[model samples]
Target: MNTRDLLNRRAPVRRAPASNPAMFLFGALLCAAAVAVTYWAFVRTTTGQLADESAWREAEGAMPGTKLPVLQFLDSLPLLSLFIAGAVVLAVTIKRRRLAPAVIALGTFAAANVSSQLLKRFFFDRPDRGVVTLDFNSLPSGHTTLAASAAAVVFLLASPRWRPAVAAVGGSYAVLAGAATFINLWHRPADVVASFLVVGTWTLIGGLIMLRVTPDWNYWPPGGRGRGTAPVFAAMCWIPGLLALVISVGCYLYATKSMTALGSSEAMLLYFWSGLGLIIGVGYVLSALACWLFSIQAGDQDR
Candidate 1:
């Protein structure tokens, strides 16, 4: 056999089940749980409102004399760019017969965004929950939702070989977009977090739908050139996520005493930065989780 033929013969083909009922059910459960938790946290609990308000106040000019036009720019990222990128990625990566999955994945973005708006307007009611804030419920910031949903859809459209890289880049973008909301005082930490969860839940459901439709298209080849990208992407995600968690914990520990008094400006600033770090950490962790959840195996290809 030729060298190319020899390699193909030696390389193992990955395989996945025709339908993953467990993953689909798990995704559904996760989506429901996220919605419940978000609603309970933002609308049902007084402590939730208090914590949210404190975070909001700290984020909104906690340092004083600081202006964040750049944050504003990040918060105002255009949705059209997201749509265009999704279209381009789908065009390049998806096969003609596999177009249905891509279309469903892209539609997930719109569904997720609309859900956030509807939840904010109709379902989540902030009726004098003891925390001082605006009248409207803002548990899930619309901007953060849009950013995170965009990231999630991109991940869904990516091939298994490219998923890790997409996850890393997309997670970073989502985290920055979330942090920008906090920095600009446009949303509380909880708001951004809820948005992430919302996108994650929807992405899970959408991914399962894709997997169900394109069971044969999602696999990795042994000894493939693209094999390296997955592990590299995982490393990138874990390192930053773990570091951010450590930093957030340390900051919280350092500021604990001052937080009781709610008096020290330094403490508040520390908390603010720590909260931002936590957002980054959580975004990446969830992105990584989503990648894991959507992973499916298929028969080996001829190539």
Candidate 2:
């Protein structure tokens, strides 16, 4: 070939997207740390122990007939219903004909629940500790685990374009279900928080797997397809989380001081509600973060 022909014979090169696998790995590690810290606080720390028992005692009062029926109904939702719904969502929303995302998404639910149960049964024990709380371990509530895990599955199954809305709505559902448990005295605040962390951990791991197995379809475009309200959803998470943190800290301090001075007073009741709000806020925050994390661009295809 002549020199002119040689200069024109350049080969096209395909470059990878800006997304880094290390980011997902870091997210997974961060989630794991959250779970570990939450578990340790509940099981080992004096303040954590006192706070949990106080919240439980404050929440364990008699409930009205109206609220009892509602909470009981929420608690009685069948596991099969979640599986069926998850299957349907997976069938409908998945644009690409890939099995890895679906299988890993569903597996996340199982992993989270099984891990929670195993931890509750064998790993952690709630000591008597001279308190009136139950001796049995209930750090990660089984009911909350079911709710949060189900939400994670739905979030995973949703299309990348719809994930923000799914994260907001589904996170709200999980939060409400967890709140119902606290309102009905089914679990303490720490129990629900631990359940959230467990679900977050498994969901992050599942998200990393999805990124690896289906990088092409698992990301947002450069201009972002101009779809989804992830930023709005993230704002929803941050606003409530900040407010709840302030309220919960105040209530926690009050409860700690009042146990000796006022005993089981209105302060304890305030503490219970505030702690419950904190759990819900944290749940939403984690869900929103996961939604954003999973939306990272997978490859240069969309760009």
The local distance difference test score of each candidate is 0.71, 0.72
Top of the candidates by lDDT: 2
lDDT of 1 by residue, 42-128 (tens): 567876565556556667666454445755566357554376557755675545555676677777888888988888888777778
* Candidate 2, poorest ten consecutive residues by summed lDDT: 294-303
Query: Residue 111: error of model 1 in Å?
Result: 1.5
Q: Which pairs clash inside model 2?
A: none
Off by over 4 Å in 2: 1-17, 61-66, 80-85, 93-96, 221-223, 257-263, 297-303
**Best prediction by TM-score:** 2
Give a tens-digit lDDT track for model 2, residues 132-180: 5576778798888888888888777766677777788778878887887
At residue 285, give the lDDT of candidate 2.
79
Backbone atom clashes (below 3 Å) for every candidate: 3, 0
lDDT of 2 at 25: 75
Indicate the worst ten consecutive residues by lDDT in candidate 1.
294-303
